[model samples]
Target: MTQNLQYFLIPFMDWRIMLLLWGGVFAGIWVGAIPGLSGTMAVSLLISFTFSWEINDALAVMCGTFVGAVYGGAITAILLNIPGAPAAIATGMEGYPLAQKGEAGKAIGLCTTVSLFAGFVGVAALAAAAPIIARFALKFSPRDFFLLAVMGILLIGSIGGGDPIKGIMSGTVGILISMIGMDPSTGELRYTFGSLNLMAGISFVTAMIGLFGVSEALTQFRTSGAKSPKQNLTKVIPDWPTFKKYLPLAVRSSLLGVFIGALPGTGGDVAALLAYDQAKRTTRNPETPFGHGAYEGLVAPETANKGAIGGAFIPMLTLGIPGDAITAIIIGALFIHGLRPGPMLMIETPHLFWMIVSMLIIANVALFVLGLLSVRPFAKIIEIPKSIIMPIIIILSVIGTYAIQNSVVDVFYMTGFGVLGYFMRLYGYATGPMVLGLILGPMLDSNYRRTMQIAEDRLFPFVSGFFTSPLSFFLTASIVFMLFSQTKLYRKWRGIE
Candidate 1:
């Protein structure tokens, strides 16, 4: 215990390590606030520069960046309706509306507070229950992943503003768009139409920039000369009573994030969306309707994604499996540092684990301070005249899209999607479901194919497997409940409407 304590305290004892962590967090926030500049890219670049540095120093900086980047993604989502990262897609649902209502400062303040709390929850889970959670995550099969994607798709109804049919149509169109590239399994061309650019498939990041950023710019053009909302910055931080009111929700969403983040192939993006949907369903009364600026809507995704920071570390440290793309990069860093990551990693290098936990704690603290300080400035960005801001937003969207794969074709694709999104919005179709579909479509298709292959294409056995496994059974039940909750009968029984 004394040795463990010493290991954990070592990073704090070194001022250089502390400085590196703080700097990393600060840099991460700005980088992640810009679309296409992902945590993965930042960390990967760090590996090249930090290879000669001590492993502890490299890990400290990277971990801090990871936590800060996830939090930063919500910044743009709130102010601009353009998520800086996929994880913040759900945040934009309510956050953008709040910004329009001149409550951007208050909304961000609450997001910062809940994010700090959730970060600690994730770190706590990583410290105390990592092994248990890691073992449980291993129980998931391909079928379960498919079902999870299905559950994500079902969120179309929740995010879809008014018309469920239009939402479904939007989502289905997104899925079809997602299928434009070559099939990974069969190596067959999909909707590519023999175009080399189409063979690479449309990157989700490109679509996101087009659908959210560019689309938002075009939408604003419809109503010319509209002044931006004046944010209320007097009381940026959430009062104690406000925090207490949403404490249960923060806790619920954070725990959900941890579990989802621990699952391989899932990350903050999936967790945030799922938590947002769950909160929407469960919270009977909000100050405003969802999609029109609900506080609960903001709280759910913010907490979940922050909590996922800790959850992402669980599998990497314990099982040598990357929980998400960022973790996968971290795993490679571990190998480069002469550390083998696997079941025996903890036994052989327990100090590394404790040190990481300490680093994350420090990072979260930095995030809280920096986040609060930046809220006013970030909110001010929303107050800029739409005439000036819209063009800049379109330029940023094009830059972000081109940055994805350095392809000009992606910029064109993004512009096209932006126009499509503007028209869809005009026609009462929500763009959120389309992005959700694009994100989850590949996961669903790949996992379903794998599951069927495992079942030898036998329909009966494949269906029965869902009920036979305890994990699958639980997921099946949750899916059933999710579907049932969408019905008028269930909503009336529960007095929701």
Candidate 2:
């Protein structure tokens, strides 16, 4: 443990590593702030570039990018009414309203300060509790995972806010869309209409950019002479009293972010939305207002979003399962370096895990510094002509989608999803559920099938699990409670139950 702590503190010990890590942080912030560019894309692209580097160096760059990108998304969310990443969708709901009110700088400051604090909470949680959480997570089986996925799906109530039914429909559509590729069980085509390219399924990143980026750009064009909101930078520092009031909420959101982030198939977006919902529920007085410029609103999502960085690494390091897309990309990086991430990783490369933790610490600090000094500059980006900005967004979306695999088919898929996204939004549907479903659908399908296969081989043990194992029983109960909680009958019975 003492030796492991040494690795966790290595970035502090080595100035060169810390400098390189911070450099990546700066680059990631800029990349992620741009519309249509994502942290996942940035990290994935970096993998090829870092292929020749040492394992630790490669990981440092990836961690920096991950940390920076998560926070970077909020910049666009606040200034442009566009979420740079899906995790920032919640941020846009509240942050944009603040921007419209000419408090972009203050909002950015509040979010930045809380984001840094939340990142620390997440890292601290991971450092202290990863092994324990991993142990608990190991007890969950496919049924539990499936139920958890359903719970995630049900979260659209808070995510959608305006219309719960629309959220459900959107999530269902996302699940259906997720089924577009090859069938998990039979390896046969399901929704692909005989096109060779369609067999692989829709790209989530393209869909995200289309739904949140291009669609938003199109919406912007509908209003002529839309001047960029005047962004004032006079008060870019967080007030102490305001900070003190929300510190508890920030801590709670950060913890929630970590917990949700550690769960395989659930990522930062869900964590952010969940944190937002919880914060809204717990607020005694949401300053600025709930959905429009509320300081708590920015704090909740921003904290949870950044905190999710550490939370996401828990399962990745302990179980070799990625908690999010960015970590999935990191897994590839690890494999390329002949490093396996799992329980064995803890045993074999304990130092590597600690290095990642250290990288996160440095990256968060770097993000704080960069975000503080650069808030004004970033807010100024909103002043650029939409005609110029939107076109660039479209081009970047095209390039980023193609860069995934150099496939032209992805470009067409992206355009198709963009069209679909436009329609979905028109019908009052929330895109967050769609993003969540797309991410978790494949994971649920594969795991459920594997569990069933194993069950058939040992029916007695599988059946007995519900009665014999406390973990299984608790998970089953939780699923039942979640399902019941979402029903009209339960709602009426409990009068908003």
Candidate 3:
């Protein structure tokens, strides 16, 4: 125990490691706040630069940047109605409305505060129960993942902006669009329309950028003459009472993040979307309605995505498996450093695991401090003139779209999506469900096929498999409960509606 403690304290005593952590967080916040630049990209770039550095230094920077980038995603979501990252999609639901109401500071402050709490929860889980959680993550079958995608689809109602039919329509279209590329399991062309340009399929990131960012610019053009919201920046940090009020929700969403993050392929985006839906379902009599300016809406997703930071590390450290895209890059980094990251990782180098946990702890603190300091500046972005800001947004969208794969065709596609999203907004179809559909559609498709193949295309076996496996059974039950909860009968029983 003492030796473990010593390993944990090593980073704290090394001033260079501490500086690297802070610097990484600082750089990460800005990079992540920009649409299209991901922590994955940032860390991947860092690999070449950090390959010659000591392992501890590389990890410190990567850990800080990872935590900061996740937190930075919310800044654009709240202030600009554009999700800097996919994980912030749910955040844009409530956050932009709050910003429109001139409460950007409070929204970001609350986000930062809850995020720190969630970061701690995830770190605690990593430190105390890494192996157990990692093993549990491994138990999830393709069917179970498919169930998760189903749960994600059910969220259309929650994010539908009070229109179920429109939500379903939009989500259905998004799913169809998601299928336009080659099928995942097979080499067969799908909806590619005999165009080589469509062979690679549309990236959800491009869709998200167009649907939210460029479309937002077009939407604001109608009101270009309207003055920007005058933000109140005094309360940049939540008071104790305010923080306590959100404590229960923060805890719930954070745990959700940790678990989902531990899942091999699923990451913060999935966790945040699920947490937002859970919050929408559970919270009654909110200060404001959901998809508007509900504080609960801000709290749920921010905490969840932050918790995912720690959760992503859990599997990486314990099993040598990448938890998410960024972790996947880090795994490659570990390999370059002559470190084998798997079952034997701990047995051979126990200090590495302990050091990582501690590094995350320090990085979370850095996120809290840096996040609060940036609230005033970030909130100020909302006050920029629409005429100037909208054009800049369009420029940025084009740049970001091109950055994805250096494809000019994607830029055109993004422009088309922007126009489509504008029409969607005009017709009262909320854009959220469509993005959700885009995000979950592939997961559902790939997993269901895998499960079917495992069952040898037999109906009875496929049906029975869900019940036979403990995890599948739980997921099936949860899906049933979700369906029931959406019924009027359940609402009446709960006396919520």
In model 3, state the lDDT of residue 277: 87
Model 2 — TM-score against the truth?
0.86
What does the lDDT come to for candidate 1? 0.92
Give each model's whole-structure lDDT: 0.92, 0.79, 0.91
lDDT of 1 by residue, 1-497 (tens): 99999999999899989999999999899878887778888888899998889999999899988988999899999999999999998899999999888999999999999999999999999999999999999999999999999999999998888899999999999899889989999999999887998998988888888888888888889886877888889999999999999999999999999999999999999999999999998888688988898999999999999998899999999999999998999899999999999999999999999999999999999999999999998899998888888888877777777777788898999989889998998999999899999999999999999999999999988999999998889999999999999888987887778
Q: How much lDDT does candidate 2 score?
A: 0.79
- What are the runs in model 1 whose C-alpha is more than 4 Å off? none
Error of 1 at 328 (Å): 0.4
Task: Report the lDDT tens digits of candidate 2 across residue range 9-44.
Answer: 887888778877898899888878765577888899
**TM-scores for every predicted model:** 0.98, 0.86, 0.98
In angstroms, the error of model 3 at 419 is 0.7
Model 3, TM vs. native = 0.98
Best prediction by lDDT: 1
- Candidate 3 all-Cα RMSD: 1.0
**After aligning candidate 2 to the native by TM-score, how far in Å is the CA of 56 from where it should be?**
3.4
